[model samples]
Target: MNTKQMIKENNRLQDAMKPDNLSYYQDMVVYIRSSSVEESKGEELLLEIAQHLLDAQAKGKTAEEVFGSDPESYCKELVEQLPKMKGLNRLQYHLMIPWIALTWFFFVQALVGFITTWTGGPVERMTQVRISTLVLIAGGSYVLIHALMRWMKNDTFQPDEARRKINVRSMGIYMAITVLILIAGVWLGRLLPVLTIAPWVSLVLFLVGIAGTKFLFSSK
Candidate 1:
C-alpha cells in the first residue's frame, strides 16, 4: 500500500484494538524505529509491522503471539539485516558534536541567568576565562558521550520521523522543564556553595544526568 493508505490503515488498526494491545503495538514500533539505521526504512518497517499486528488482531491474536516473547531482539536482528546506507563521514559526525554541545551550553546558561534574576539572586557575569573553560568542557563532554554511545553500539539513527515531529505543546513542556531545572539549580547552588563557586558545576551535573538517563533508557 501507499504511504497515505498505510497510515490510514495503521490508524484504523489502532482504533480497533484494545488500549493494552494498542500500547504494545506502539511500543513495538518505537523499538523498531530506534534500532533502524535509515528513516525511510524505519517507516517502511513500522508500516509492515503495523499491518502484521492488524492481521494478527483480526485472527484474535495478541501482539506478543504475532511477534514473539522477545520483540526487542527481533527488532535488533531486523536492523542488522537492513542494507547499510552511505552515512556521513565519521569525521563530520565528530566535528558536529562540539557545535551541538556549545548550543546546549549556551541554552543552559541563559536559563540559569533567567532563573537567578527571577529568584532575586545577583546574576554574576562570567569571566572570559571561565566561559572559555566551560566551552572546552562542553566540547570534551560531547566527544566523551559520542565515544560512549559508539562503544555501546547505542548511537541513534539520524533523521528520525518521530523525533522530527514539531509539536508546539511539546516545546512548551520542554521550556517549562528547562525553567524548572534552572530554578532548582539556582536553589541548590545557594544551598551548596561549591555550585555557586563553580557555576559550571551545575551544568556538568545536568549534562551527566542527561547522559546517564539516555544510557539507561536506550539500554532497554
Candidate 2:
C-alpha cells in the first residue's frame, strides 16, 4: 500500500481510540492526503502536514471516511486546495532498483575475483577493499530500500528480493548458479601452479569481508 493508503487505514484505526487522541491520527492523515509535494522536505513540510491532519480532525470529516464514496473527491480537494501538501517532493519510482543493482554489482565482482585468481593471476590485497566497498554500498542500499519497501509495500524487514517470494525451482536455480560460480572459482584456483592463496582461504575471506562490511555499515 502507498503512504496515503497507510495513513487512511491508520486513520480508521485511530478513530476507535479515545477522542482526546484523535488529533494525532487526523494530523497524520492530513499529510498522507497531501499532494502538494516538497522539492526538498524539512520540518516545514512536516509541520504543514501535521496541521492539515489536525484540521481534518477538528473541522473536517473523521479519518474513517477517507474510504467513503466522497473520499476520492475529498482527497482530491484536499490535495489540490490544501496548498501546503508537502514541500517540493518529487515522485520516486522504486527504492528497490538501486539496492538490487548494488548487491548484484558486488556479487559479479566476487565472481571476477575468483576467475582472475583461478587463471593464475595474482589477486591484490585491495581486492578485499573493493569487495568490502561494494558490500558496504549494498548494505546501505538494502537498509534504505528495505525501509521504503517496508513502509510502502509491507511493514517489516525482508531479505533480498530473490530470497523473498520464490518458487522452489527458482530457489534451486539460485543455488545452482551460486554453486557454479564457486565451482568455476575452485577450478581456476586449482589450475594455478602454486596457488597464491588456498581456495578455502579465499572463500573464508569473502565471507569475513561481507560480514565485516555489513557490521560496519549496519543501519539497524
Candidate 3:
C-alpha cells in the first residue's frame, strides 16, 4: 500500500494512545513521510500487509525473518554506517532518545512526588541518608522501567497513526484513588532502605487502603 494508506492505518492505531503519545506517533508518521490522509488508510493498508504476511506464512517464513527481529537493532546498524552530517540527522535524533528518556525519568519522579503530596506524603524522603539512595535507585529503576515500557510499546507495533492510544483517560475516581495509593507506595518505597513507614503503622494502613482501593475500583 501507499504511504497515505499506511498513515491512515497509523491514525486508527493512534486513537488508542494518550494524547501526547498519539501526537508523538502522528508526528513520527509525518516525519517519516507517511502522513497523507485525513481519514484512515489503516484498514486497507493493513489488509495489504496482512496479505503479504499471509503469503510469507504460506511459504513458511518466520515472523521475525519477515518483520525483522528488531527494528531498534536495525536502526542502530543504520546509524553506525550513516555518515555524520553537517547538521542534525536521524542518528542525532537517536541520541536525543537518551535525553528524552532522562526527561521521562525526571518527569516520572516529579509525578511520584506529586502523587505523594496529593495523597498526603512527600516524594523525596525526609532524610539525607535516603536522599542519595533514592536518587540512585529511582534514577536507575526509572531507566529500566522506561526502557521496558518503550519496548513494550514498540512491540505492540502499531503504526504511527494508530487511533486508540492509552493515557490521560478519565477513569476518574478509581484512577485518582489508585494514583494516590501509588504515590504513597512510591514514597514508602523510597524509605525501604531505612525501614521507614514502620510495620505496625503500615500494616494497618495497607489493609485499609487495600480495602478502599478494591471498593473504589470495583465501583461502577
TM-score versus the correct structure, for each prediction? 0.44, 0.27, 0.24
Name the regions of candidate 1 deviating beyond 4 angstroms: 1-16, 89-101, 108-124, 127-220
Instruction: Report the lDDT of model 2 for residue 141.
Output: 53
lDDT tens digits, residue span 50-163, model 3: 454446656866445554755345433433442343333333323333433433444444455456657877434621133333444444444444444444444344454542
lDDT of 3: 0.42
lDDT tens digits, residue span 40-146, model 2: 23223333444445556666555444334343354444455434423212212222344345545545556767787788776664144333344345444544444
* Best candidate, lDDT: 1
RMSD of each: 13.5, 13.0, 17.2
lDDT per residue (tens digit) for residues 129-206 in model 1: 244345444555564554444422321222245444433434565566556545655555445432232345556655
For residue 187, model 1's alpha carbon misses the true position, in angstroms, by 26
Best by TM-score: 1
Stretches of candidate 3 off by over 4 Å are: 1-87, 123-220
How far off is residue 175 in model 3, in Å? 36
Question: CA lDDT of 93 in candidate 2?
Answer: 23
